[model samples]
Target chain A: MDLFEYQGKEQLRKFEVPVPEGRVATTADEAAEAARGLGGRVVVKAQVQVGGRGKAGGIKLASSPDEAKDVAGQILGMDIKGHTVKRVLVERAGDIVSEYYVAFLLDRSERNYLGMMSAKGGVDIEEVAETDPDAIARVHIDPLLGISDFHARKLVFGAGIEPRARKGAIAMIPKLYNAFVGLDASLVEVNPLILTGDDRVVALDAKVTLDESAEYRHPTFAELKSAHEVPEQERLAKEKGLNFIKLDGDVGIIGNGAGLVMSTLDVVKAAGGEPANFLDVGGGAGAELLSNALEVITSDKGVKAVLVNIFGGITRCDLVAEGIIDAFDRLNMQVPVVVRLDGTNAEQGRKMLQEAPNERLIPAETMLGAAEKAVELAHGGGA
Target chain B: MSILIGTDTKLVVQGLTGREGSFHGKRNRDYGTDLVAGVTPGKSGEDVDGVPIFDTVAEAVAETGANTSMVFVPPRFGADAILESADAGIEVIIAITENIPAMDMARTVNYIRTRGNGTSLIGPNCPGVISPGKANVGIIPGEICEPGPVGLVSRSGTLTYQIVHELTQRGIGQSTCVGIGGDPIPGSNFIDILEKFEADPDTDMVALVGEIGGDAEERAAEFVKEKMTKPVVAYIAGVTAPPGKRMGHAGAIISGSKGTAEAKMEALGAAGIRVGRNPTEVAEIVQELRG
Candidate 1:
C-alpha cells in the first residue's frame, strides 16, 4: 500500500528522520491556517500517489498565507496522471544547498535489501540510471545483518557526497533503514534528501510503500487509509474480502488465482474484448462469496459480460458450480456469464451448470473458447 | 525421472493436523506418495488416517527417514516451519503456505543460503511438486498429469493446472510440474528448475509459465541463452495488466516501466525461446517442439 507524502513524512518522523514540519489540509482555508502556523512561508504540494506532480503544476511555493491558500485551492482538484488531488501538504519552505537521493528497498532478484544513494537528486532516477549509471551507488545489505556503519559509509563515499554533508547523510541513512525494516515497508525513498543551508539533512519528499501482508503487525497503518482516496469499486471489494482491481473494458473477469486472473484478462483481450476488472475469488469460492463477487462486478455499469474461469485444485469445481447457481438465485444479475470449469471435479461441476435453470449462465469446454464466448456476448452477439 | 521428487521421496508434512495440511497430506498419500510421518508440535503420536504425527521435524526424520517436507503452516509461523525443516536436514522443502511476510522469507532464505546445506526450498505460496504417477509431494492434482518427456515450471497454481490440462488434451505429457509460487521472493526460481531439467535425462523440452513481476523471467531468459541446451517455450501472463495495480498475486504488479509482460516476452523471444501469446499457444509450441 502506497502512502501519501504527508503520511510518509509522518512515518519518517516516527523513525527520527528529520523532515520539514508539515500539516495536511483538505481545503484552501486549512492550507492558509497551516501556512500561518508555519510562519507564513510554505510549499503547497498536492498529495497524490503518482509522480511528476511538480510537472503537472500540482506543487507551488507560497510566500504568504494568502498565496498558500490560492496555491492549495488550485492544486486540491487538479489531476496528475489520473490521480485526483484530494489533499495538500503545507510544509515550511526550506533553503537547499544541494539535493541527494537515498532509498532502501527489497531487491527481489537478489532476495535481499538494497540501498541506493546518488549525489544527483530531485529528477527522475530511472533517467539518471539510463543516462549516467555511475551516478547512483547501490549496495546490497544482508537481510540478517542489516545496514551497518560500514554500509552507510560505503554508500556516502561511493555516491561522492560533499564533505560538508557527509556526516548528516551518514547519520540519516541508518534511520531510514530502520524505518524501512521497522515499518515493514517494501520501499522507503527520500528523493531530494536535501542539505539545508544550516547544514541539516532533511527528507524533502517521502515515498513509502508498505507491505500489506505485514499489516497484521502494524495496526496503526489502518488509520492512514483515507476512504476518500480509494475508488468505490475497490473499497467495496476490500469490504467483501475479494482481491480485485478495477480495469477499463466490457467483460468482467473472475478467476481462482492471480496468474489465472491475469491470464483471463489477457485471453479476453486477445479474443477482442477488453476486461473490466481483475477479481480473484481465491482458492475456495462458496455460495456467499460467489454472490458477493457477482454483485461487485455488476456494480460497474461498463461490464457488459462476465467470465468465471476456475481451474480448481484446492478449489473444488463442483462447489464453485453450486456457488454460481446459488449466486444466480440471490442476485438480480443482468450480464451474461461465461463459465469455464476445469481441474478437480470439473465434469460434475459442468454437469451441474448444464442442469441449472439460469439461462444466462453459459458453460464452455476450454479457456480460449470461454474467453471467445464472453467477448462475443460482451460485443452484443448471441449468447 | 522427475527433477525434484520421485519414488525415492520420503515425505513428512508440517502442520499436519491443521485443515489444509490434513487435507492435502491425505490426498498426496492417496496419490501413492510415500507418506512416512507428520509433524505437529504437541500433537505427537497422533495420526491423521494412520500417518503418525511427531512433535518436531527431527523426530519425524529420525523415525521415518523422511527426506522431503511439505509445509502447510499458517503465514505467521511459516518461516519457523521452514527453518525447523531445514534444521532437521530435510533435503527438499516445498512450502504451500501463502501470505508469509516477505521479511520473514528473506531472513529464512538468507539463513538457509548461509547454512549451505544444499536444501532445495520450492515455495512459500505454491502448489507443491508432482512427478506424474511416481510421487506427489505438495498439492498439484496428480490426476491431470501424465508421465512424459516435458518439464513444466510456473509461478501460479491454477494457471499451471490450466497449461497442464492443455498439454494433457494435446497428448503432451509432463515429466514434472513445479509451481515456484507467486511471492516476490520464492525459494526456487525458473532458472533453478530449468537447470535441473536440462540435466535430467527423462525431460525433453520445457514449458515456462511466467507473469508480470520482478525480472525473474528476464533473468531466466539470460540463463537459458547462456547455459541450457533444452528447448523452452514461454507464456507470460498480464499482457493487458495496467500499471500500479497488484493483479491478484502479491508479486504480480507492474512497477514503473519494469516487470511488464511485453518486456518478459521480448527477452524470452530474443533468447531463441518460442514465446506463446496465450496458454494454448504455449501448449501448441511445446507439442511442435516435442515432435
Candidate 2:
C-alpha cells in the first residue's frame, strides 16, 4: 500500500528520521488551523499517491494562515494524474542548503535490498538516472547483514555527498534503512533529503510503499487506509475477497490467475477492446467466488461485456460454470459474457454452460476467440 | 531427461496436512511422482494418502531419501519451510505458498545462494515443476502436459497450463514445464530455468511466458542471446496494464518506465527470440520452430 506524504513522514518520524514538522488536514479550515499552529511559513502539499504534485499546482507555499487555507482549498479538490487530492499536509518550510536523494527499496532482480543515494535530488530519480547515471549511487545490501555503518558510508561517499553533510547523511541512511525493513516497506524514498541551513539533515518528502503481504504482522496498517482513498468498486471487491483492479474500459475480465488475467487483458486489447478491470478469482475458485466476481464486474456500469477466462489447475471449470449461471441468476446480468474454459473438467463445464439456456453466456474454445467475441459484443455487435 | 524433476524425483511435501498441501500431494502422487514423504511438525507418523509424514524435513529426507521438496506452508512459515528443506540438503525445493513476506524471501534466497549447496529453490508462490508423464511436483495439472522435446518456463500457474494445453493440442509436447511463480523474488528466475533447459538433452526449443515487473525477462533475453543455442519463443502479458497498478500478481506491475511488456518484448525480440503477441501466437511460434 502506498502511503500519503503525511503518513510516510509520520512513519519516518517513528524511526527517528528527522522530517519537517507536518500536520494532516482534511479541510481547508483544518489546513489553515494547522498552519497557524506551526506559526510560520508553511508548504501545503496535496496528499495524493501520484507524483508531479508541484507541477500540477497541488502543492503551494503559504506565507500566512489565510493563504494556507486558500492554497489548501485550491489543492483539496484538485485532480492530479486522475488522483483527487482529498487531504493536505501543512509542514513548516525548511531552509534548504542543498538537495539530495536517498532510498531503500527491494531490488527485485537481485532478490535483495537496494540502497540508492544521489547528491542531485528533488527531481524524478529516473530522469537523473537517464541524464547522468553516475550521479546516482546504488548498493545492494545483504538482508542478513542489513545496512551496516560501512554500507551507509559507501552510499554517502559514492553519491559524492559534500563532506560537511557526510556525517549527517551517514547517520540518517541507517535510520531510513531501519524504517524500510522494520516497517516491511517495499520502498522508502526520501526525495530532497535537504541539508538545512543549520547543518541538520531532514527528509523533506517521503514516499513509502509497504508490502501488503506483510500487513498480517502490522495490524495497525489498516488505519492507514482512508475509505475515500479506495474507489467504490475496489472497496467492494476487497470486501468480497476478490483481487480486482478497476480500469477504464468496456469489457470486464475475470480469470483464474494473475498472469492469465493480465494475458487476457492483453488479448482483449489485441482484439480491439479495452479491458474494464483486472479480476483474479485466484486458484481453486468455486461457484460462490465466481458469482461474487461476476457481481463485482457487472456492478461497473461501464462494462458492456464480460470475459471469463479460466485455465483451471486447482480450480475446476465445472464449478466456474456453475458460478456463471449462479451470477446470471443472482445479478440478472444484462452484459454479454464470453466464457472460455480450459483444463480441469473443461468439457463438463462447457457442457453445463451450453445447457444453461442463457443466450448471454457464450462459450468459446480458445482464449483468443473468447476475447474477440467479448470485444465484438462490447461494441454492440452480435456474438 | 527433464531439467528439474523426472522419474528419479523422490518428492516430499511440507505442510502436507494443510488443505492445499494434502490435495496437491495426492494429485502429484497420482500423477506417478515418487511421493515418498510429507512434513508437518507434530503430525509425524501420520500419512496423507499413504505417504509417510515426518515431523521435520531432516527426518523426511533421512528416511525416504526425498531429494525434491514441494512447500505448501502458509505465508508466515514459508521461509522457514524452504530454509528447512535447504538445510536438510534437499536438491530441489519448490514453494507454492503465496504472499510470503518479501523480507523473509530475501533472507532465505540470500542464505541459499551464499550457502552454495547446489540446492535449487524454484518459487515461494509458484506452481511447481512437471516433467510430463514422468513426475508432477507442485500444482501444475498433469493432464494438460505431454512428454516431448519442448521446454517451458512461466511466471504464472494457470497461464502455464493454457500454453501447455495449446502445445499438447498441437501435438507438440513438453519435456518440462517450470512455473517460477509471480512474486518479485521468485527462488528460480527465467534464466535459471532457461539454462537448465539449454543443457537438457530431451529439450529442443523453449517457450517462455513472462509478465510485467522486474528485469527478469530483460536479463533472460540477454542470457538467451549470449548463451543458449536453442530456439526460444516468448510471450509477455500485461502489455495493456497501466503504470503504478499491480496486475493481479505481486510482481506484475509496471514500475516507472521499467518492467513494461513493450520493453520486455523488445528486449526478447532484439535477442533473436520469437516474441509472441498472445499466448496462441506463442504456441504457433513454437510449433513453427519445431517443424
Q: Write the per-residue lDDT of candidate 1 for residues B1-291, one digit (tens) a residue.
A: 788899999999998899989999999999999999999999997899999999999999999999999999988889999999999999999999999989989899988988997999999899989999899988888888999988999999889999998899899889999999999888989988999999999998899999998999999999999999999999999999998898878789898889999999999999999999888989988888777
Taking the tens digit of each residue's C-alpha lDDT, what string does model 1 give over A64-125? 99999999999999989988888999999999999999999988899999999999999888
TM-score of chain B of each: 0.99, 0.99
In model 1, pairs of residues that clash are none
Give the candidate number with the greatest DockQ.
2
Clashes of 1: 0
> Candidate 2's C-alpha lDDT?
0.93
CA lDDT of every candidate: 0.92, 0.93
Which lDDT tens digits does candidate 2 get at residues B46-157? 8988889999999998998999999998899999999999999999999999999899999999999999978899998999899998999989999988999999999998
Model 2 regions more than 4 Å off? none
Best by lDDT: 2
Model 1 regions lying over 4 Å from their true place:
A226-228
